[model samples]
Target: MPLVRIHLDTDRTTARRVLQLHREGRIHHESREAARDQALRQGRTPAGDPVFVGITNGRRDVQLLYDVEVYTDATR
Candidate 1:
């Protein structure tokens, strides 16, 4: 199963909560809908702050690299 990396514009607290859930194996590698459901249960806002950032096509390492690139580019 592919990994779903959800990026959020919310505060660190909320983002950390969601990341923790993912790391703890609570959120399975299912559809995006499943992730959204888990995130909601985990206290993520449904408005727009905590939104789907990106999805990895079974390339977790590459996803990290891409994220770093995007972040670096955005900082410029």
Candidate 2:
């Protein structure tokens, strides 16, 4: 499975909720679709293309940044 990292433009509440759903396996992989679907299901509007909820501190916190990696299993 590939790892997808998305920076969400959200606050602590959003982060907590998303993280919870993610941990509970509610979303499908950390891909864009998963995030978007999750947000939609929650009655929230997703940004676009791969939706990500990020956080901020001083000024802007949350954002949308992703990192994907492919993997394979082999048996000899």
Which candidate leads the pack in lDDT?
2
Write the residue-wise lDDT of candidate 1 on 14-56 in tens digits: 4445456666755423333454554455444333222334333
Overall local distance difference test of candidate 1: 0.36
Tell how far residue 22 is off in model 2, in angstroms.
0.8
Name model 2 segments beyond 4 Å from true: 1-5, 28-65, 68-76
For 1-76, candidate 2 gives per-residue lDDT tens digits of 4333444455555556656665675642444565555445544443334523333343446443433222223111
What's each prediction's TM-score? 0.28, 0.35
lDDT: worst 10-residue window of model 2: 67-76
lDDT of 2: 0.45
